[model samples]
Every structure is written in structure tokens, then in C-alpha cells.
Target: MEKTPLEDWIAYKIGIRPGSLSREAIEQYQLARIRQTVALAKEKSTFYREKLSGVNPIKIMDYVQFSKLPFTYPQDIKENPLRFVCVSPKDIDRIVTLQSSGTTGEPKRLFFTKEDQELTIDFFNHGMRNLVGPSDRVLILLPWQLPGSVGDLLRIGLKRLKACPLPYGIVQDPEAAIAAAVESGANAIVGIPTQVLGMARHRKGKELAGRIKSVLLSTDYVPQAICQVLKEQWGCKVFNHYGMTEMGLGGGVQCSDLLAYHLREADLYFEIVDPETGQLLPEGELGEIVFTTLTRQGMPLIRYRTGDVSRFIPENCPCGTILRSMEVVKQRISGKTILAETDFLITELDEVLFSINGILDYQSTLALTGGKDCLTIEVKTERKNKIDPVAMRQVLHTIPAIQQGLERGTLEVIVGESCEFMPISKGTAKRMILDTREQQQRPSGIQHS
Candidate 1:
């Protein structure tokens, strides 16, 4: 395995001489940048000015002191995004508005300047080198029509790296995407997790199994089951990427070792803290992911709580890089729901459903029906007529939560097949367990679980 290219790229960006990249040097640079960012944020942004009014930047000389600052939450952005902008509107290059589920609340709006976007493009350029190289044709199955969308920025990054990008957008039609890959002779693919799995399980999927050399799954959670299936079917490498709209679309990516993520440390300072108490945890302990922008100029967020769950790897990477690594994020703190006295998570369902062969995709819905917590699963398979509902229920029962729920008679499970599966649109949200009990009115005899 080769060392991650991000090491050299980050070192160069921070002005560290060759062969001088160490934990101490990185920490010193981060401390200096953190103070600078604090000063900048306090001077320009109204939200940060009030939030950090009591603290002096010079006093926060160490990571321990920095961790004592108040956290910035997602709700802060949704409430009044403009208050966080450091630059004037004329200098803002792009504004990404993320709508909430209902129309009653304001959506989150993230502002970015040209330089801010350039930082993301630079990270993508070097991070992609782990899976793609010059002259390689890669299929991009993400949103690219917008000016500053992730796919569009990735295209620019690949072009800078001298690779050919075949922008196919999202995988609305798996067959069409596979055809595009075949037509372009694409050697690598970047896409969402389940959508790519659908492509690999398509009838014509076998055609490109041996031809495609690598895959990069992003924009959503990457299930290990999906990765195993992709590797088994295509005999290719599968890489996982962790990012969101708040992180400027590129945070970290896996190296050739494929063990954990090599974070973009030069641009951001990452921390793991107890989600409930907000206390920073020691290395190797699982906790919520917190990040502070070290180099962002447009809208620098200090100690932003990401709500994501992961931990820093305590051991140094075998690939020989000093840059820290984080475990692949498998679940979000907000993704879990209490149903039938069980903590139900979408990842739990993913582990059970995706492991079964012949399952292409599934849609799960949880609701209260007839005084019981009911779970309805609409499964899509390669062969429409082959999936047996009883067998599917049997497989679902293998999950400990489902088994306990069934045993207690507090839950009911229903399994069926979808004749046609409609893929999500470019701007739509990714798949997850839909809990509709809040919207549904309980009957007279039903009691809350």
C-alpha cells in the first residue's frame, strides 16, 4: 500500500519543508491558524462576535483551551445564516440552501467565496489521486448541473489532475448509467452507496464487472456490506469518502490501504467529543465529530458540532503517513429512533438487508398501525417474481431488534416487492428509515410505545 497523497499536499499547503511533517509541526500550525481564525471570526461575523465575546484569542493557545469554547450547532445556521458570513454579499461566490423536511422553518444557507471553493477543489484533486490517475476515465454519478455542486467541483479537480471525468449525474436510471460507463470505457466510478449497488446488481451489470477498476462512494453512509458486494462482484477497489455541505463538500477520503479516512487537516481542525456532555474524548473513543475551519475565509465556523459519529484511529496508519485517520462514519447521532423499546437505526437495517443476495434496494417505513409499531419494507430485486415475502420476513427476523420486537408483540413486520423502483432526483435526500408516527394520529385504543 502507498502512503496517502494528502500528507504531502497538506504539508505543502501549510508551508512545511519536505520531510518535516510531524505531529508537533501539525499541532503548532493548527494552533496558530486556530487563533487567526478566532480573531477573524470575532472581528467580522456578528454571530461569532457575540458567541466569542468573552474569550480572548490569545488565551486559547492550546487545544485544551480551544476545546472550552461554546459549540456552534446546525440550528444556528438554519436560524440566521447571514449572521455567520464574514465577507460581504458581493464577495460570496455561492450560496447553498438546504431545506428542512417541512416548510415551517428556515432552511440552512451556507455561503462560500471563490477562495473557499478553491480549497475544496484542491482537496478533491489530491484526495482523488488515491483511486484515479492521469488519463483515467471516471464516471461521476452525482449532481453536476449547478455551478458549485459537488460533482462540478469534482470535475474541475479531476481535470486539474489530468483525468477525464464523464459526468452522468445521479443514478436515476442504473441501466443508463452502466451503459454510459461502457460507452465511455470508464475505469473508475464515483457515486452514492446504494445507487451504485443497484447498478452492480442490474442485469447488464456483469458486462462492466471486470472492466471498471475502482469505485468511490460518497454523499451518504457507505455500508460495509455494500462495499463487500461491490468488491466481490466487480473485483475492484471500493473507497469511502466522508463529507457534507457544511464541510465545503470535501472533508476526508480513504487512501490505498482502504482502512480509514485521511482527513484534510490543513484546512480543518477535527475533534471527537461526547455528544451529550460536549466534553472532548481521548483518542480512539467513539464520539460526535466536531470541526473548526482553519483556513475558510468566507464563513469560518468555530467548533461546529457535526452530529456525526466517529473516532480518531489511535495507531499510526500502516501506509506511512503522519496525518491522523478517522474511522468510517457509519451512523449519525440523529439517525436513531426509539421503537418498541429498541433503538432502531437505519444502519442496523442496512447490515441485515444488504447482506442477503438478490436484494437490489429497499424502502423502509415505520408507523403505528392497529396499536402496534409496524415496519413496512418495499424491496426491489433483480428478478421481480423471485423474491418471496415469507423468506424476506425470515431474513429480517434475524436482526436482534426485530426479533425482540416480534417476541414482545409490540411490533409488526410486513414485507413486499416493488414492481418498479424509482431512483431519487439530483437534489433529493438519500434513503433512510422513515418514521411517520409523529405525523399519524393515534387511535383511541393505541398507547404510546
Candidate 2:
């Protein structure tokens, strides 16, 4: 195993001395590892062998050539998952089956060895160190029933660092979650963004206003409105974590500087590409995120298209770590829309809706009505009947961009006590904007909000 230390604090956990190599040396090391991974996958996995048939791993040499290798799409995994596995069934330590949110597709299964699980645990341990301390009692709000589930893995990491972990599972009851945190003396909380926001708005959630010191929002997109609310209401520093089940659970975490994510470059290679053309995009250009596992042994995904959209932030972080940063990831390609010659993203709608005082949840849909393009947004409010047209307009006035969309007749507002059109469950993928103007076929089985 080859290693290059990027930070002093990270050196001990990742097994590399701090600043031992220059930027050039680190790239060289990564390229070498990439070659090794390609060769190993080609040798052990029939899928990789056929996909990378003519490509000579050793002669490929650079990133450009590496980029020439065929991409592995989600459909390939969906159709022939077993062919991608490099290890025997007996050696697989854990298997995570994730259902697609579309409500009509088969689940994607992710395999991991014990060593692979440890790598993710190592990532959690080091990543938690950025937002927590040895004395801090952290509250994990995800499920922990399975042996290698997210919360269970995180608990193991926190225990390894001498930090107390209070695993309360998912936030089924916001009041109860708050009570557990208060009783356990929790200083930090981790969970999905919506659940965390729901907890923050609860009357009891406000009771922990000054008690909790930090929050880590994950799973779905973390809206600016939610981030602002969490910071103001809880008086805590908010951080974002970007990860997926296929990436062995832990991928990247934001540093204390709160710029962008400091990627787990040691375990995975990240790239951005044109969603339609599949060509590599320059830094700062919006595109699909592609990843290749450099150290994963159970099943090394080569150039797997993640479908999540984001860009690489080229600047060095003020946090002083050489590890690269990525722009905050937003909704998948299916959730993006161009309404009446104006663009609308789920994140933008979230910012507009969630910032309002009475709004609890919202959903936007684009449709063709009477030869006109119309965007109908349904907002669920905390005050129920109190959310009349006058109150709704006042709240909508806060966002100037949305106001422009309204004036142009591209946006329409519908305020209600409860929005039946929107799926409010915390378990499914959160897709706030649904563009029904076109036969909007959602990605496989993932549902839209």
C-alpha cells in the first residue's frame, strides 16, 4: 500500500506522515494506484476485463488516457451486478441493498469486505474529528439495526476516538430525538437535512438551542434555507458530508473553514463530466460526478457514474489542507428544469420556501395548461389555514428571483395546510422539483418529491 500524508492530524489515522510528498508526487502515486486497481479489476472481474479490453493500464500513463477508459453506468450495474464483483461471495462481509427512489426499479446492491468496511470507519473517525472532540457526545440520527449500517459504522468510529455516541436511530419523533440529545448531553447531531430541520423547528428542538455545538447534514441536498435556520436556531456550526452507499459510505466532509468538502482522495478518485456527452468537464463546470475506487477490494467500481451533479472547486481551501474541494452537490439531473426560459433548481426552491416563517415543506411541478408553460408550487405551512394568499405573497416576497419568475408567469404559488402532491416521508429520495412538462421519467426507481 502506498500513502502520502496531506495533513498532520490526518497522518496518524490514514497511515502517512504529514507533508511527506509534493503535489506532483501525490499525483504520481495516485496514477500508480489507478493502474494497479485497473489491472486487478481486469484480472478478477469479467465485466472490467471486457470493458477495458484494449486499454493497456501500464501504458495509459496519465489522466487523459485513464479518462479514455469506458464508463460504467448505473444501468450496467442494474442489469448485471454480479459480473462486476471481483471477490468471491464467501469473502463479502456486508451487502447494502439500496432501493431506487423512482418507485419502479430494482434495488442496487453494494458489497464490502471487512477491510473495506474498516476504510470507511477510518474515514468516519477522521472526518468526525473535524466537527467533534474526544469529550463531545455525538447523536447519530440514522438507523443502526443492520450489522454494517451507517449509524452502526459511525458509532464504531466515534467509540474508536473516545467520543460517546448516542444512537437514537432515525428521527421518528422529533420531540423524542431532542429529549435523547438533551438527556445524553449531546454536543453534536448527525442526520438527513430534512429530519434535522424538522427537529430544529419543533418546540422541544428549540430547547437545545444553545446546548448543541455542531451539526452534520447528509443523505440529501442540504438547502441554504435549512442551513441558515439550523445555524440561527441552534447556534451551532453546520457542516456538510457527501457520501453514497456505493462509495463505501464515507466520501468527504467539510472542514471547520466551511468552504467545500475535503475529499477522501486516498480511497477514491473523483471526476466531473458532461451528463449528455460523457466528456470530461473542466474544474468549476457543472456535470455528473464520476468515481473510481482505488482501494476497495470487494468490488472496485471503475468510472462509475453517480448521477449526482456538482463541480470541482479549483481553489485551495483556507483550511490549509491539500485535499481537493468540491462545490456543494445539488439535485440529480432529473430534478433540474428550465421553466419559461428561466432556470429553476430544487435547491433554489428550497431556499425560497424553507426561509419563510410558516412554511414546513414544498413541492414544485411544471405542466402545460391551456397552451402555456406553468409552474405550480404547493407549500405546506406550519400555521395551516393562517397561510392565506396575503400571507403567502408576503412570504414569497423574501426571494427576489422567485418573484421575477412569478411576474414572468413562469411560477405559480399554491399555499395549503398539507401538500398531498409532495411525498413527505424521510425514507425516500428528496426531489423537490418535478418537471412534468416533458414526460419526466425519473431515474429508474427513485421518487421525486
Candidate 3:
């Protein structure tokens, strides 16, 4: 018999008692868990003991008091990883290493015990319940070559739920991934947004029409434009998953309501704070997202600051789940651009350019051309032989954002040959905004932004 979903188990353990929880009861449960986690961190972790010195977890009865705790920066993890490990070396089950975008400092190394890893698997099992059913096949586009990687963990959860998983790793070959999905009778796909977009674009005719029923877009933000294209082309529901390796590979996911993400509140505490000041913000206000692990036993992070920006939705979700939901995460603080005193986020550009048909990949850079600040967008098409530049330009002009910028002389468009440009993030990672105005001039026809 298929086991119960992790969400149901969590609800039972927390005494949520479906159809009976008041807002006050939920908040009380969260506060009690936070207090327990704080006590554990101070007792076991050397780094937290020093950082949280003279602090009494029992006295932290409210949000304001909890916010007073010292914040954990990424640099601390990078400089001294073992200092944060709560468990002995012998007890460690696995170590996950993530290299910072070379633009930042050194890579961060995170340690996890068997229990810590299982929490994430549990979260995946619960979150996927929103989209997949027993006997449904899920195509995993993350790496699973290693023993305890994200894909491998997800495979375990899918098997527990009685759903089949195709662990194809990342999209080294979009065509092959699509072929495998269709041949395997996959009804759901889990992957990064860009690769999934490529797969949807490359899918010819009705080959994938009835096969794919849903997609759990993970590892990066899913642009509205990309979601629009996938729904129109494939006729499938798209659910966005927000997570990072630091946050245990799974954080939150959107339900059928599709308004916001129902967070993993059972094992994690979420907070929003001012990016510059580090002061906590009220619900419904946008700020940097911070997280505290309530259940991770190996390397427990207290008040760990995540650079991504988002806010808590104050209203209840239409789906009727009692867990708190968060707004769709926006671009990082550093990715915002300024043009004619008008601010443009990288996601804005992604929505406009990616929605156009035939464009497979793209890069947006802000540059100074002829002493005028200009937004230059470069795109690569899947089929260069079949592309009509005139027709493509018309399609680009149809987007209100791009068309407005072009009409006002604030933006420029350049279509490049396929594979001409690569992202700076390294190895299949897609970074839309690259500011090149500060760099030395490039040779002719090579735009800098």
C-alpha cells in the first residue's frame, strides 16, 4: 500500500487538526518550534554558541525578540563550515558542496546527517502531492549520478508515493530529455525553467500533447512569460518550486490555487527583513528572505540570510491550506538595473524576450551606446535556418515592455547566432542580467552590458 503523504503526517504531528486551526493556533505552533530550534543550536553548534552568546531562547516569546538574534551570513559558512556542524564527523551522512558564483567569495560547504537529508525528502514527497498522483511518472532533470544528490533523494520520495521517476539529470541534450519523457510515458517534469522551456519549444506537434500533465519548475525563478508559453504550447499545468541547496534542496511550492507558494513551515521558519538594515519587516512587505532550520540536526543554520527577495501574503489562500504562503520570489538585490531613472529587473526582460516564439536562449545586458544608457538583448534561436529575422523582430515589437523601451530610445535588440554567448554563472546556469557598461570596450559587433 502507498504510504501517507508527508504533509498529512506533519499536520497530524503538529496537531493542526484539519478544518479546525485558527490563525492564532498556527502562529503559536511556529513560535514553539522556533524556540526549540534556537535552544538546540545554542547547545550543540560552536559557531551558534559564540554568535548567540548571552541569548536566552526561552525569553524569545515573540517575533521582535526572535528578530534580535544575530544573523548568519554566507561568509561565515564559507570561512568555517565545520564550526557550524552540530553532529560528530562520524555521524555525518553526506556533505553537499556548492560553489558561489565566482563573483562572490569561496564556495559554501554544507553538511547533513541522514535525518537532515530525510527532512528534505519528506518535503518533496509532500509538495509533489499538489501535482502528481500514484502511478504518475515524473521526469527529474537534476543530477542523480551521486548517491545522495537532489535527484536521488527525489527518486526515493517518488517511489514512496508510488510514482515512477525518470532521473535524466540536467538538460545536456534537450531533445533526448523530451524523447525520454515521451517514451517513458512521463506525465510530470521537474527541472530548471530554461531547460524546460527548451524542451517545450523543441517538442514537435502532438507527440507531447497528452503525455505531460504538469511541471514542477525548480532551481530558479519561473518567469510568467515562460509559464505562459508552456501552458499555451503543451496544455499542461505549471507549478513553480522555490528552493536552493542551502535551504535543503526544497523550500516551498505552489498549490492548485497558483497564487503563491505554500511554504515548508513544519521544518523551516521564514522571515523577511530589510536587505540593507537586516531589520525584520511586517508581513506583506517585500524584503530579503531569511530562514531558520527547525528540524535539521546536522548543520543547523539560525537566521540564515537568503539574498533572494519576496514577501508573505497576508491573506488566506483560496486552496484552504492552513500553511502560510509567500509571494513568487523576485530577482536578487544585485540584479536590478537603472535606465532613464526607470528601474528594470532581469525577470522583466526574461518575460518579454522568452515569450517570443523561436528564441531558444538569451542574455540581457545594460550598456552605454553613443553615450546613451541602453538595454541590449541578445537571443539565440533553435533553428537558425527557419528563422525570419523580419518576422522575429515583429514578434519582439509586439511585447509592450520591449516595444515601449524601443519607441522611447531606451533599449536595443540584437539577435545573435546560436551558441555565440554563454552565461557567466558557468555550466548550464542561466543569469539574465549582465551589466557590462563598466568594462572596457569590446571589438566591433560584440556588445557589452
Best by lDDT: 1
- Name the weakest run of 10 consecutive residues (lDDT summed) in model 3: 421-430
Could you give me the TM-score of model 1 versus the true structure? 0.96
On the 0 to 100 scale, the lDDT of residue 109 in model 2 is 76
State residue 350's C-alpha deviation in candidate 2, in Å.
0.5
Show model 2 residue runs off by greater than 4 Å.
Answer: 1-15, 367-376, 381-383, 386-412, 419-428, 437-449
lDDT of 2 by residue, 204-285 (tens): 7788899989999876468878889999999999988888888888778888887688788778889999999999998889
lDDT value, residue 251 of candidate 2: 72
lDDT value, residue 377 of candidate 2: 68
The Cα local distance difference test for each model comes to: 0.87, 0.77, 0.77
TM-scores of the candidates in the order shown? 0.96, 0.89, 0.88
Clashing pairs in 3: 435-449, 436-449
